[model samples]
Target: MGALEGRVAVVTGGTKGLGLKITEAFVAEGARVVVGARGGAGADGALAHLDGRAVFRQTDVRDPASVRALMEAAADRFGGVDVLMANAGLSRPGPAAGLAGADWAQVVDTNLNGLFHCVQAAVPYLERSGNGRIVTMSSALGSRPAPGASAYCATKAAVEMFSKVIALELAPKGIVVNCLAPGFVDEGMGRLLKQNQAVWSTYAPKVALGRMGTGREIAEAAVYLAGDAGAYVNGHVLEVNGGLAW
Candidate 1:
């Protein structure tokens, strides 16, 4: 039996990167998992690897109706939701000064508004669990400003505060809300790092560990906060950045 034994969880954007890693970790910890993605996680049978341990649902977190449908499916299939990894949204666009008007809006709408929709939709089912937990994906960018990454930073900053408010409001109901922020996952951020090896190389030493972190490492952090160990750890913003910012 795993730490999340018998619980049902929803991991958004679980097709790849940190989201997929987190979903895999939850399943390994004995949870029934449901993954969400914009158009499924894989392009060519990438999802088949999970076998039946997980299932993918087409979701657009930015759309309220789509989010509601997603929650309905989870409730009907898994009976109710115990843990919700509100990990949807994108990490694109660009610097505050460089991004087009539409690009900025897109980033904010998905990263901020979209995440809000997931939590709002899952409230009813989470309440049914009688001990709900919402672990949202934030970023090291959320903690301190990283140059050329304003959109991502803004949304994440909002994510931390929003989850805190949620924690305060839902504490009376036995629901925990927290933020999971990673500096850069070795797997998913490959493109960003590769695009700017100079940047990564320069900052490598700052990580203290002298390297980037793996998806599993970030997933482990999510698991800690999602399970019973973090029951009392509410409204907190966890930094899994290899001590990069501290």
Candidate 2:
């Protein structure tokens, strides 16, 4: 049997990029996943290959009600949630000196506040599951510095610290909360960076492995964190950055 056989997972931003890959991996491992995105069509398109193991939900992670609905839908469809992948995020790249106020707000709202909304909505249900797991997304830049990504980096950094604090608070409640900090990944924002020759050239050699990590690699880490293998792991930030050096 698969590691996550008969498990139920809720993954936000699950319609594309890293989130989509994680959803696919979960389904492959025999988990029923509720995929959430702001656009219904995107959600539907992303997980169309999962057969009956996954469902699409219209969700705006920034809204607590929408996030709550997502968790409730998972329970109504496939029983209570065992895993919560708070992966919804966006980046508005610009230098801090000239960044637009709107861009900053959008990044902070979706990356930080949105994660809080999902966690708050999922906690009660997770508690009832008896073995709850939360995997929040962060970036290598969360701790490192990047010139044009101040807002994104700041929100991600905040997420790391938030995950640690919450992990401590929820450990006694039987919920394992951890953070996934990826660096130079080959999907989502990382994909966009690779398309820029100037950026990719600068970052490629920094990875000790000398290449970008794939979405599947990150997904595997997610599985470890959410599965029985991670039973004793909590309040940790697992970095899947291929050993990036300064």
Candidate 3:
């Protein structure tokens, strides 16, 4: 039997990129997943192979009501929520000196506030699950400084601290909150960065592994955190960066 057999998971921004990989991994582990994203469920048959193990809900995590409905939909469909993967986030790259206020707000709203909304909305159901797990996404840049990524770095740093704080507050309620901090991955935003050879050349050597991390690698870390293996782990920020020196 799979490690997460019989569990129900809610994954935000699960329609594409790294989030999609995590969603697929959860289903493979025998969990029913409710995917929430602001956009449509990606290129038509993206999730068809899951064979009905996953369902999609149009969700805007920045909106409290939308996030609430997402959690409720998961409970209504899968019976109860055992895990929450708060993975919806975005980055607006620009130097702090010239960054637009609107861009900053957009990043903060989606990355920080949106995560808070999902956590708050899912807490009631998570509390009832008996063994609730929360895995919040962060980035290596959360702790390491990066030029022109002020918004992303700041929000991710906040996410790490926020996860730690909630871990303490919710531990007594049987809910474990942890953070997943990934380094330069080979997909999503990381892929975009690699497209610029000039930029990639400069940052590639920072990874001791000499390569970007894979989505599956990150997903496996998440599974460990959310499954029985992580029952005793809490209030921790698990960095999945391949030994990034920077």
Overall lDDT per candidate, in order of appearance: 0.84, 0.92, 0.93
Q: Find the candidate with the highest lDDT and give its number.
A: 3
lDDT of 3 at 37: 91
State the lDDT of candidate 2 residue by residue for 1-246, as single tens digits: 887898999999888999998998999888999998897865676677889799999999989898899999999999899999999999999899999999999999999999999999999999999999999999998999889999999999999999999999998889999999988889987898899999799889899999999999999999999899988999999999999996
lDDT per residue (tens digit) for residues 127-213 in model 1: 889979999888888878877778888999999999999999988877899999887668776447846978777777778777778
Output candidate 1 Cα RMSD: 1.7
Off by over 4 Å in 1: 41-44
Q: Which pairs clash (backbone N, Cα, C closer than 3 Å) in model 3? A: none
| Model 1 per-residue lDDT at 94 | 70
34-140: candidate 3 lDDT, tens digit per residue: 99998883633677789889999899999999999999899999899999999999999999999999999999999999999999998999999999999999999
**For each predicted model, how many residue pairs clash, with residues at least 3 apart or on different chains?**
1, 0, 0
